[model samples]
Target: MSWEESYHGRLRAMAGDEEVLIMVGARCLLRDDQGRLLLIRRSDNGLWACPAGGLELGDSIRECAVREAWEETGLTPTELAPIAILSGADTVGTNQWGHTYQFHITVFLATAWTGELVTETDETTDAGWFHPDQLPSPRTANVEKSLALLAEYDRTGVFVAP
Candidate 1:
């Protein structure tokens, strides 16, 4: 099992099933050389989102972004640019075993990447490149924020509070 699963299991055993945990995660707004954004359809909810995952112990935030991008979408991030830091009350819905979480996410713009497009079927059902204006419906909050941050960065070369 993943560290997150093991940690959550231990936490649930100690604190009960309804406890809220604060998680720190990393998300990557990966883009191809053609400037198309890469989005993955989550296996759990089937909503499109940028590649992301919770950080494991001893992992740096950038390392987590690189690892999550490759794990979920098979894209090796070559360059990661800090886009924004998003923190708030975002519900991470219950797991199959009914464990819920809240997360503070660090978002990055993967400006350069390599490797063929492939989806990790266990975590993602679909992965594809889409134009910014042609994104799929029902985007995850992180994805929406990433896009907005990218737009703002492009416009002013700065990412301000939204």
Candidate 2:
């Protein structure tokens, strides 16, 4: 079953012409002192992924990441440390809408966290902290990339390069 059959959501971004490209989204890398990152089991596909979602209208990309993180994990990130800017063809949700050209995503390393992680949200079912090496069992491709980016940031503290 494709993402389209799994999720009834839409992805639209201001690219070119009048058509809104429905492929852009954001992902957040929240890590703790133990080097564990936050992950949410998506309610729609049961796949583990970083606390992330699509960018809505009238929302800055940074704000969108923060909002999606909070909504999905029920935790507030205090700071946003730039990690890596990922650009590539991405299939938003469960839809196979002919992967769009490089969905510009700004990955971040959030060290400070507040509130409690809850599973009472509609978007996410389960939430937990896992070591980078011991990530979840069923994580999305983007989740894997996000984890790699986090490790890269940890090693160099530089987000631009690999």
Candidate 3:
């Protein structure tokens, strides 16, 4: 959906950028056979992040993740399994556009996907796969949190809630 048409975007427009809104979003994590993580360079902030977006009017959280991944990178996730619900008090931030949001993001692990990768889109300046050990600079802070959530799931063998 266009920013003007999205629920969060309309909320931001009505409430204004300075007003902090509670937002629900989702992020999808994809890995190559080599275990390299997929990352996108966001056009808005130039921050490298997983393909993610806020929930639109009719999408389930999982649908949002898949939609976002497709929108930003042209990859369609065939199967996405939720790994965590990241909604901590610290999960709040003001974007480069000065819109503050407290995010309730569902992070997903994509076990299967299809489509050719596109490096550039309206939402992203560049997209590529990277090793966790050698991530691109000026990446999103959420990258670390997403990884941590996954690690927590790994350690506990349960879905993370934080």
Candidate 4:
């Protein structure tokens, strides 16, 4: 089972379905040598997003970022630098199983990586690299925010919060 299913299942069993759960996760803004950004089309929502997922037990945020990127996009991150920490009521959502969750998502920039890009059939339907100016339409809110932060980071060497 995935981390979400395992954790949500355990929580539901312990606290009942009405309890709101807080999930910590990480996302990687993977860039190729040519400076193209990597994006994955999620199987569940059919929306393009950065490679990301909830932290599994015993995994650090950096490890989570690396693992999620590899799992979803077949890339092995060699270096990761944190870019932003996004949280708040706006990050709250419900899964397909009707379990409510609040997310604390740490966004990371992978400075170096290597792998053949292939989408994980279970999680993503497609994966590709795109120039920032030519990004796919209708990206997730977090992805849009990450892209903005990435630009700001590139320009100023620091991520400025909005």
Candidate 5:
């Protein structure tokens, strides 16, 4: 379905133009065969970010994450393990469209996926894999923190929040 016909879009249409919406979304963190993290350059914001989107009605959060990963990165994350669940007043942000949102997102680490990789998409302009210590510039504000969560997970084998 078109984004405007999706659940959040319908909800946003009902809310005031300036209202801050509480949106539930999910991020897919994928690794290439060489173990680099995957990031997408968001078309709307021109910032590098993990493939993500708001959850739709009649879909679980994991479904939302996998679906968004497929749409934005052209790969279906086959095996995902939730590594972090983040949400707070601090999570609020205004998009390029000036729509404000407080994001509740689950960050998923994918162990396997299917399909050939494609960078260009409706939501993303580019995609690439980066080593943990060598991320590209002009990335999303939360990239470091998210990576830190992943690092913690690697060291401790525990999710950031659960």
Candidate 6:
């Protein structure tokens, strides 16, 4: 078998009998009134992704999302109705070694939050609001999924995948 297949098989074995191979993490899609989404530049990897991070011990996913938003962009996110609950195997993620990988992600679409737009922390080297139609160059793959969830919210006043 190929290296990736073998690795996946091992992971599957490691997760034996469990439905999901990983725990839940948190993410937030913070949008401005103009339909612009806030994105962060990670200091570690320097990739532009939505202001998000993994959950800490004893922290709820929503709390993790809000905290990550603040830590990265210096913006306080107000939790709105949940936008989506995405579940799958092989959900890709990145490692500290710059290796490509996968994880299950729980994404949220928050409508209420407060904070001026400013760079405040090293967790994110830069922060900016980008129009959905004019997303920054080299956007991450998951941005499209977030945007699709937002669009679904706009169309149905709820987050139901089409």
Question: What TM-score fits each model?
Answer: 0.83, 0.77, 0.95, 0.86, 0.94, 0.76
Candidate 1 Cα lDDT to native: 0.80
lDDT scores in order: 0.80, 0.71, 0.88, 0.84, 0.89, 0.70
Better of 3 and 4 by lDDT: 3
Candidate 5 structure, TM-score to reference: 0.94
Candidate 5 — what's its lDDT? 0.89
Model 3: per-residue Cα lDDT over 1-162, one tens digit each: 678888988888999778889999999998777878899999888899998889988899989999999999999999878999978678888887788888899999996899999999989999998988899989988888887877787688799885
- Where is the poorest 10-residue window by lDDT in model 1? 1-10
**Which segments of model 4 are wrong by more than 4 Å?**
1-5, 159-162
Q: Measured by TM-score, how close is model 6 to the native structure?
A: 0.76
Q: Which of the two candidates, 1 or 3, achieves a greater lDDT against the reference?
A: 3
Q: What order do candidates take by TM-score, descending?
A: 3, 5, 4, 1, 2, 6
Report the lDDT tens digits of candidate 6 across residue range 27-79. 79887778788888777777778876666656787888887788777778875
Q: How many steric overlaps are in each model, in order?
A: 0, 6, 0, 0, 0, 1
Ten consecutive residues with minimal summed lDDT in candidate 3?
145-154
Tens-digit lDDT string for candidate 5 (7-108): 989998999679999999898889777979999998887899888888998889999999999999899999999999989988889977788999899999
Better of 1 and 4 by lDDT: 4
lDDT of 2 at 3: 30
Best by TM-score: 3
Worst ten-residue run, lDDT, model 5?
A: 141-150
Instruction: Write the residue-wise lDDT of candidate 2 on 1-162 in tens digits.
Output: 233332213333223333434444567888888878888898877888888766666778778778888988888888877688776444323334433333567777788978888975888779898887787778779877776677677688786543
- Cα distance off (Å), candidate 5, residue 150: 0.7
